[model samples]
Target: MSLTKIVPSKPIKLYCSIICPWAARTWIALTQANVEFEYIEIDLKNKPEWFLKEVNPGGKVPTLKYGDDYLIESAVTTEFVADLLPEAKLLPSDPFELAQSRLMADRFMEFVFPAFRKGLYQGDVAGLSAELFDGIEKFEPYLINAKPFFGGSDHPALAEILVAPFVSRLYLAIESGLVDSATSTKLATDPKYAYFNTWAKNLIASPGVVGTFDKTTNLEQIKERLAPK
Candidate 1:
């Protein structure tokens, strides 16, 4: 299947919250693609009237406005930006590889995050380790041959763009003792996870991930969100 490229006739604008990992995914994609887009920060707690009325009634961050039209959903917008700028090579050129990248990213979004949330909010360390280890193990195979990134891309690709936010938070969570220290040790030192560690380290340091994510602020916001309400 040929990759379809959509170049916008009008300027692009993205409304996102800095603390939102979902929004971070789209931000990374557009930034990595080197697209010139207006960055409009949304106050998620109190959304603007027009944003609620016209942009997205659902009031979700990462709402992308391409001229007069709008697109919501982080995953949709992330991939859309990659597809829009084919020259960036954000998605793989090969069909199967492209599918694999999307599949891995989707898996992370579906299983990994929910597991992390369940563990964090419920304070289930054992359950957290078990679920996280399982999810990480599943992700291992994809990176076994990675040259520090999915599909051996020198820069972050679609998979990295999608999963980087959560992975970065996972590391921070571990360092902050929110996640099990043993789990972090194993991920860092265990030979079984060497490939994943390499890929993760590289992903964290990549320009796109680094540019869009602020470790300290995001960690604090996450803790605040997870605090007893």
Candidate 2:
């Protein structure tokens, strides 16, 4: 799909942190849309006063400044950018397909991610990993058509953009031994999850997805954050 270049009247700036999945979502959307914008990295641990009071009162990363308007929330930011660049076709034109894409993203956030977080941070890694696998099972059938991405689109769709960051994190966790090996194996080799496994591999390798991903740094940060107190 061809992306339409948007020449903004004012400067566009994105406030983000490399380690933040939410920020990654917006970054991927912007990159996929081929939008030119300034990226400003934020230190989540020690956010500056201006960021807290002015940029985003809630002090969240992935805040977008379009001209003088500030936009918060990753999903909203991603959608806004996609809508702004219609020629990108980041989202499907068909209403049913678009709703399906949104539903898929919603499912990952609601079900898969919480399980991943619990497995990573709360202990019982084995049990939680199983739960995570179960959550993944819910979406495996969606990829049964041999499409490289969700919804059978050759290009990364809205669903892929929203979920790829977390999916990449899951791979990092598996490789780092934070998640159980058995769970990882099931995701990789089991027939039930074969489609999802293939989809994940392609998504991770996509330029927009990998461009914003720093696996080494992200893995180390995850290890640090999940370490025992």
Candidate 3:
């Protein structure tokens, strides 16, 4: 597997909101790829007409404008950027390894993300936290040999990039007392999750991961959204 340098033919612009985990995924990917681009922050509550009509008909953030072409959805946009900058090695070059990375990300998104969201928004913190732990238990074996990332790379891989945003949010939620302390302790100290704990700590400490995360503001918005209406 060889890496190819990415030379963008046109300017890149990223449409994103810091509060959105999905948008944060694309932001992290762009930074990891070392791609130069303009950042356009969107107000989700008051979405602009131009953004809706032109950028994304669905009015979603994390839209990528590559020259005149626009791409939506965080996963697709992240993969597009990774594919564009093969030299970054964000995604594995080998087909099998790349598929494994994608599979891990898919499983996290399908299992853990929903449970985490339910815990955050629905006030079922304890039950959902247990459910989340169960999901993580299932995911732990995949990381047995993964030193710092699921791709078995020293640096973050596509799987980490996809999941780190939510993990960061979970950290914030725990700090803010939105998630129970028992769950947090288990996640951090349990022998079963030692590998995942290390991977998560490294991911959170990574350059683009924390930089792209606005913990204070994002936590506030999450609380507001989860507040009784």
- lDDT of every model, 2 decimals: 0.79, 0.80, 0.80
Q: 1-229, model 1: which lDDT tens digit per residue?
A: 1234344557899999888888999999887777678999999888999999988999999999988899999889988898788878897888988888777777776667765676555655567678876777776655534686777677888877888888877777776776667987887899987776778788888888888888788778767756666
TM-score of each candidate structure, all chains considered together: 0.88, 0.91, 0.90
Candidate 2 residues 1-229, lDDT tens each?
2456466557779999999998999898888777788999999989999898888989898999999999999889888888877867898888888887887788777767777677555644665676776788775544334387766788897777988898888888876787767877877788987767788789888878878999888988877766777
lDDT of 3 at 82: 83
Cα lDDT for residue 26, candidate 1: 94
lDDT of 3 at 227: 70
Residues 1-229, candidate 3: write the lDDT tens digits. 1234245768899999988889999899888777678999999989999999878998888899999999988889988888887777897777888787778887777777776677665656665676877788777655535776665687787778989899888777766777777877887788987777787788888887966998889888778756767
Indicate the residue-level lDDT of 220 in model 1: 82
Off by over 4 Å in 2: 1-6, 121-124, 142-146
Native-to-model Cα distance after best TM-score fit, residue 107 in candidate 3, in Å:
1.7
Better of 1 and 2 by lDDT: 2
Output the TM-score of candidate 2. 0.91
Candidate 3 clashes between residue pairs 3 or more apart in a chain or in different chains: none
Top candidate by lDDT: 2
